[model samples]
Target chain A: MTISSRSGSPGPDAAEETTVIPVVPAQDGADETTTLPPIDVPVLEDEEFEPQADRDATFRPSRAGWAARSAVWLVLAWFVLAFPVNFLSPFTLGVSDVSAASEAAIFAIVGLSLNVLLGYAGQISLGHQAFVGIGAFTSAYVVVDLEMGFWFAVAVASGLGLVQAAILGAVSLRLTGLYFALVTLAFGNFAQQTVFAIPELTGGEGGKEAPRPAMFDSDYSYYFLCLGFLAVVLFLDWRLTRSKAGRALQALRENPRVASSYGINVKAYTLLAFAVSGLFAGLAGALMAHHDEVIVNQKFGFQLALLFVLMTVVGGLRSRSGVVIGSAFFALLHSGHLLSLLEPVTQTIFRFSLVDFITGTIGLPIEFVALVIGPILLLLTITMYPGGIGQQIAPIREWMLGRRFDRHAGKVTEVEVNDVRA
Target chain B: MNLPLYEQLALALTAGVLRGAVYALVALGIVLVFRGSGIFNFAQAEFGTTGLFAAYWALEIKGWGYPTSFLFGMGVAIALGLLTERLVIHPLRDSSRVTLLVGTAGVALAAIGFQFWWFNETLVMSMPKINEAFFMTPWGAVVTVQELITLGVLAVVAVGLALFFRSPSGLAIQAAQQEPVASELVGISVRRVSMLTWGIAAALGGLAGILAGPYLTFSAGFLSFGAVGALLPGFMAAVLAGMRSMPGAVAGGLLVGCIEQLSSLSILDGAVPGAGALVLFVFLLGVLLVRPQGIFVGKVATA
Candidate 1:
């Protein structure tokens, strides 16, 4: 210490000056004596703090994109296959029976419309069949009474349906799930009463027959026509799921609060979703009216509404394929074949009509299979596979690629399942 | 089209109030179930129908009943209610509100189907005419003993339920609704409480149905009709009450009944022929606009 250092050692100049400590710690806990000059650290300006070049990379779809594309392709292929099958098959699948296929297609349309609202939007509508009825009634009136061309009738019917939906949407826009459901129920009943009351417009209890379009002279042609409509509806559905509006609707379904926070006009979107859904429903009704060559008030009663809800729920509300599958299954069952098949068994067991046997045994109608089964399936899906059948299949496809399905690996939590439930 | 003012007004009010009381009773039954549990009890009318049919069987068909067919019908209704609660509602205690509501609807449909299968005929039952002695000419309007009984029963039940909720067991029941998990954790047995609620609600519905049966003849489709009547008023009441407060439910019911009666006397009688339905919609819309939470209760926090 007494020895003179390079700069100073207990010198008067060093003692008079202030010694500044370094803000940063030394790498090692070693002490060394050295003379050092003052250093100036350069401060980077705001312009120097730029994001990485990778941040400007071109947009890329997530893994969900490929899965969605495959789904779309699969749907298109199914439609292509169904088109010929609908034309060739007769009422029964037994011998040239296209009736069953055509009926399935018609129901498929109804189910799809319901899927748009109940499935994608997560709104429960008990009055969907009312729209169907309105479409049928309007189209029937136009085609049969107004003597409008079939396509013209369809156009007019769809327009009327839009108006009906708008009015209903306006009235029920403020209502939440259950109250919304009740209002729709009341409207359905009111429609029925009005139909019955206005015998001049509707044939009332006697019912009225609708004329088939000239284009579809034969059953095969009618089947093809229905298939065409179904195809268009299916395409529209595909487009909807892919479109921005569809995503917005889906966002609302997932979490309206979150969606609204992102500046989505919740009411406008809800109304739009409802209107689009009604448009499809109306189209289905118009097709049905022309297909059956009859439109009855009874066709759109509360029971039909219940059946429609059941169909959508059973088909797996989140998937278009599920809706179609559910609809087809229900239509086939409704064709009375299932009941006929069970006739012998029913006779032996209860000695009653098939309706009685089915309804009495389970204390629920066959139409209510969805009601009885849907919740269980939904619960199971919620617990085990929260994403429904569509999302569940992705992992299998990924596994086939010799890769572990790790997209949702750690992100899939119990809370996510509860959130989906909500 | 041009009836005397006094006559038209009196008749309209009379019909409205009388029908309104029936609506109130039916609605009260629905409100009970809704308040106890979140379910709308779509089968409330069917419960009434079951009672009516049971009364018919006991009084007219079997002819082995010491009591009047009316009393017998009430008994059968109580039994059916208990059975339904135990068999159906009890098992579905943990179901979501929508599921439960749909379940009730299913019950309704099954009940209707059963009635058709069993009865085979839709013939209406003819009960003994209610005596007119109890009726008095108030403002030249005739009010029947049946209507009085309906109003009285509604009052007693409403008051009784209010008192019941204040008791220790009622507090447990309320606790079950407020915090079902916590109540369960505390060994309160949520399922048992729900079953009890179902039983009580069903019995109230059955009683209402039996009382209303004599006025509107019993038939297979009677319950279906009754369900509509019950649904409108009950739904209105529940919505008005914010689906929580019992007092709110009662007040909502009375208000609906009165409004319906008053609307019948108004100019709207011609425009919207469904006066009762119109009144319900208007009131529901009004309440939802002004106070969606309901009169006495606050906003419906759960559903």
Candidate 2:
């Protein structure tokens, strides 16, 4: 018996999908017939062979599920927009708390800026504070000395950031891995000690004043401005990760030599990333300057750079929502607002205020709490949960997007970021 | 005490040499770890700080003898090295080098935090030098006995390392580092080699700390970011060594020290604030661009 290849789907007889018919050739010198299983050909119809992805794509959430997701979305939106403004929420945020919220938004922008370099380009900057500091100082200089408006100052700062970062990127492009990191560290030190030390520029020890925009003078309005900037940054970041340049960056990050072999201009694309990162950082720095109403050189220290790296890494690289959340969390913690927010809960649960426990019992100042606890969290994130908070909240994010809840949906089997080539 | 320009230059050179010895010690530890494992250990300087803090605790807090405290500090540094290797490094051995760098940095931060917490009462502390006397150089530079001791120890360490590499265990470490699979086939315990290298490197870092601790009043991150900052210089030296040659590291350390001191020349005094850092930054960029394999190093290192 011979098996024939069929062009169409098998009929009712296709129940036995795999029919192993053994045949013995008549020319065999064996007394017994040796069974040889023939290859079973799959008779699949062209129109019927749909992939699992297509099935998932065809899925539609029930009306009730859609209603639930929309409600949750509304709550989240209200929490972000109206809670602080005391519009629809019962709990009211104080003036200081609103200011802290603005800081959080700025931090989120900074985190995304770092994410572009570390997560996408696979370059680490230990002196990121330098970039941010330059931005702040630029904005302050423009506003104070040049008598520029808030918007013009921010624009100048961001442009300077792009120019400076591109220059630094060009210089360090020849180096990679730890060597590049060392250069950034040195540059940071240089900027801190030499550049920031100029009395005329940084306004000496007293620092420079950066007034808020006229319309956004109040803390509440300023917070909305920050949130609006954050939204713009988030949009830009989302666009970046989906573009051709972003693909090139991801390629080079995984393996620069391989990417170069494929005709990708590693240096050009890396410089683009640096410019973009710098632009965002400068914007953040300008916002930060107005937020504090007074920007000082002392604010941009080595510790702050490390904190930026920590929040970005802990927030999970390459995850937009996660970075925003992580940056906000750290900002709130740094402002001491997070502890106050959880004061009542800690009072009930642990029988003591958490801030008092950290300050009095643990003998650590409130200001240093993030520095101390952040590193431990960083270590845990890198070792055990490489995906970080983003991975943790992935299932819920997917569920809200009208997909079936998958516990392991966004689980990163291995860290997407790779080592810089020597 | 204002000397002529040439005399001042000579004095600066003399002082730089004395400071370079400590840098040499730190560079040695950095080079050792890099050669052992393909990692840029950010905690190398922090290891020194930890050791210094431990010695400080032993001496001032516990009222122990100087020699005993020094040894105890070395022990603690070695223990921290082993702990870091076992806890953070070993588990992520197969991960990318950047991850390992981050891990080491985390370890350093944690240690710094612990120091800040434990030694919060004393913001600054000083240790007595081995000898209290100072000797004036021909050019009028006053050299302390402690500086001479540091230089002497660095010479001994350099010679000792040269000899150690020819020994069986040292050779085993070299073999394991070069080719782990081949070394394993030859019945070498790669794990043990890694542990020994880390332990020795930590000890070297500890020695640098103990010797330099007396040079200035120390704070939490004494050798890292404090008054007697040596981490950047050490890293510069290691890069100058191409991250592989031990002898090159020693030579590189001295050269870096001299170059850094050149910023103190009269011409650069008011031209730039923090001119030393500017010089170092420029020098680093030049070296990286011109001879990335390092000035002292001849051959390319196997990555």
| Candidate 2 residue lDDT tens string, A1-422 | 11221112232333233232222232342445456433323323322433443445556789998999999999999988998788887776788988988899999999999999888888888888989899999898899889989999999988988898899899778888778888888888788888888878888799988888889999999999999999999999888877888788888888888888989999999999999999999999899998899888888877788789889888988888888999999898877888887887789888988878888988987766776888889888888988778888888887898887668766774454454756
Recovered native contacts in candidate 2, as a fraction? 0.52
Candidate that would win on DockQ: 2
Clashing pairs in 2: none
TM-score of 2: 0.91
For model 2, what is the error of residue B133's alpha carbon versus the real structure, in angstroms, after optimal superposition?
Answer: 2.7
Question: Model 1 chain B: which ten-residue window has the lowest total lDDT?
Answer: B127-136
Q: Write candidate 1's Cα lDDT for B1-303 as tens digits.
A: 656677767766666666556555566667667666766777777777777777767766788552577777777666766766765566656544554555576566556556655565445565443443455575667777877777787789878987887887777777887788898998898777877777777677776677777775565546454333555566666777776676677677666766766766646565654455555655666677567667867544342
Q: Chain B TM-score per candidate, please.
A: 0.85, 0.96
